[model samples]
Target: MAMRRTRILFMGLALLVLACGSTSGGGDDAMASGGSPGKALYNMNCTLCHGRDGKAGLNGAKDLTTSTLTKSEMVAIVQNGKGAMAAYKQLLTPKEIEAVVDHVRTLGRKK
Candidate 1:
């Protein structure tokens, strides 16, 4: 239970940072630009809820490591979100979304 609370608190703080950091002259973190962009983006934006390995399942997040969703299906879910997950359609570009989905697919293959 405490772990869940800690996760929630962390997510809240991350969101706070995102909100405060946004400005009219917006720019993404360097992680969004190059070198394992998917993993980097996921680390910064998703680990709190979906987790580094995509099994945290916090706030109704699904276990990506075990998800049966196809790439397109997962892309839709990420772009639109569900339940407590925030829609990334506005936050992430289409290519980044695809990259994240590709990374998610790898999670299911890990032993």
Candidate 2:
């Protein structure tokens, strides 16, 4: 029974490590295609309304999956705010906003 318990603990630890290893860590992939900081930021600020996949539309949030807004357009909207959405200019830096825009672009590519 003790040996079985030890094996179970080892398996749990292995799973935990594997899970952590799979995370993106906000690297270049996140910057280029919404992997890390961009994904993290989106989750923190946009997910509540945009949904995990950017299609939730809670409180009139637009469906990012089908959005055709260009990067510059997205950046402007993010900085200036749309109808219901509040401007993020006060919250995120220019680089952060660009990262989020990059991330939002990835949402449309999801199958």
On TM-score, the candidate that comes out on top is 2
Residue runs of model 2 more than 4 Å from their true location after superposition: 1-34
Q: How much is 98 displaced in model 1, in angstroms?
A: 0.4
lDDT of 2 at 18: 35
Tens-digit per-residue lDDT, 23-94, candidate 2: 735343434443445666666667768998899999999999999888999999988889988787766778
Q: What is the TM-score of each candidate against the true structure?
A: 0.67, 0.68
Every candidate's lDDT: 0.73, 0.73
RMSD of each: 7.8, 12.7
Question: What is the TM-score of candidate 2?
Answer: 0.68
Give me the runs in candidate 1 sitting further than 4 Å from their true place.
1-35
lDDT of 1 by residue, 26-111 (tens): 35444333334566557767887999889999988899999987899999988998888877786678987898788778777855
